[model samples]
Target chain A: MISEDYDRIDATLRSTLRDVLGLSETRAAALDADTPLFGAMPELDSMAVAGLLTEIEERLGILIEDDEIDGEMLESYGALVRFVATKTRR
Target chain B: MLRFGPDQGPLVAVALPLFEDANRVRGFAVAICRALAARGVATVLPDLPGQGESLVPLENCGILDIADGFDCATKEAWNANRRLYGVALRSGALLDKLALLDGRWHFAPQDGPSVLRDLKRIKQASQPHIRLSDADWYFDLQAPADHPDPPVEIAGNLISTALLTDLSVYAPWTPADGGPVRIVRLDSDPAPADRHVPGTALWRRAEPGNDVTLARLLADDIADWIATCER
Candidate 1:
């Protein structure tokens, strides 16, 4: 049940990434679970990252701290999905 | 007595932002207040003590002291039809701690100084300056014969380390309400000029040009906040 819930959340996240970051379908799909978002996309600089985090929090009802984020955590879409799941659990 | 229309304007209180600079609302504060006012609520946008046209010098005030002054201002103005919703743009979000001042809120954190710096870094990798017109001046990385990679940097003791610290502490995603505070966040990517605050009925507007469009958008947002808070 939880995995199914995770999948739903994951799909929403992908859509959000596309909508908020203005990513094309192909570009967004090219992302895997552990891809590095910060350096990978020039658009994902600090401001975008901050905006992304805000979008995620509003969508998933999670709170994130600047210190809580790191390269590995935001590496990919799958990674972000897992991160959201973890945060939601808490 | 006069009857107002369904699209009647909101009740708004306007004042200068909290900063050493005399003009400009903080950032996200503009959005929050505008959203509220758009809903026919009542809101007030006050300038911090020692800033704006208030006659006090920026050097004479500290963060906490500024917060205190704002609090006092809100309380003195509170009335039956008025709800003090403090709006803080960018680093101004820290002033929400002074919400106890008005006990009413509609906070938003727009692309503040650090975020602006980060954008400039990504844009031209250079610092920014205030032009004679108070417009944020930037170096054109594309001007050629310049350094590698586009970079725009904004420098000055005006944006103090203390100000940076205050801004960094705010997490726009989570309102002190433990939910998404009514907000509209602007993204630098693809440069969408407008945004919508999710979960809440509020709107988030984004636009390029730190001059007219930015200021106008903020003013619209503040107007909305005042409209909503009035209820």
Candidate 2:
């Protein structure tokens, strides 16, 4: 079974990248929170970004409006998780 | 039809294949089957009529007919032993009867209307270089009897208008009447679920290629579920 840490936001985020972007566990974990995702990761192109957004909704059980996600929100893992946490709390 | 794992125990009935990009679906099925085999479970991945190396022409097939084909395959597997389970993915989930098996595992099941909408969108997106003389067949999701023949282009495959029309109206056949459904939606699955949600939709990764890592993960997930079900 894949190792899982459900409590940590970074753990969840990394796992999400592993599943969505098909990254290895090491590769996903290697990504720092400040690491840019949108423009940096070729896999995170426009379509992949849209998919990642929808997946964030499904995985977190939260609704994310289209207007809520901009390039800035996806700039880094920290930014994306912060946006998710805020939306989920709201 | 492809067989995987040890064929001794309950056979998994894989039904209602992806209408488009049959190869990608086939690849995932192979992975899932191997995973199941590792857990000592077997699966029968039937090539949907007229697709996936099937000799039948698309014009000769329809929605209900394909569902019936699934039934035949499922029953065949069950007949081998009195036990049966099911795994349906994406548009394949339209075959609700897969739920009737001893255990049910579903991934990203879409409703008929939504699938039709996506097809229409793809057709529209592939504009300017429209292939058909009477392109309404693409827009309306129907193949008029008079509007030419089989082998129309869709999602990188040549399909029949009759089959496409049948798919356009394909109804949502939920497994509500059967066992508890384990749902994992990576794509636009209209169905609800019970825990174990994946954080990504890798079914059709937009890199214009298949996602092997996610595919393996899903196979492991399904195999784990099958092992649990057997226990």
Which parts of model 1 are misplaced by more than 4 Å?
A24-36, A54-68, B1-11, B14-61, B68-103, B107-231
User: For model 2 chain B, where is the 10-residue window of minimal lDDT?
Assistant: B128-137
Writing each residue's lDDT as its tens digit, candidate 2 over B1-231 gives: 888777576778786455553454666667667766766777888876666676765556766667666777677655566577778877787764533477767777665655554454455345524443333455334657676655556556555556667666775554565564677765323346654443334354543344456667777777777667778
TM-score of each: 0.45, 0.61
Q: What is the per-residue lDDT of model 1 for residues B100-159, given as tens digits with 9 covering 90 to 100?
A: 433222333533444433333323322113221112334343467654323322322233
DockQ values for all predictions? 0.05, 0.13
lDDT of 1 by residue, A1-90 (tens): 287887767766776677657678987777776666767777776545655666676556566654466667778777778778888888
TM per candidate, chain B: 0.46, 0.75
User: Which structure among the candidates has the greatest TM-score?
Assistant: 2
Let me know the TM-score candidate 1 reaches against the reference structure: 0.45
Q: What is the TM-score of chain A alone in each candidate?
A: 0.83, 0.85
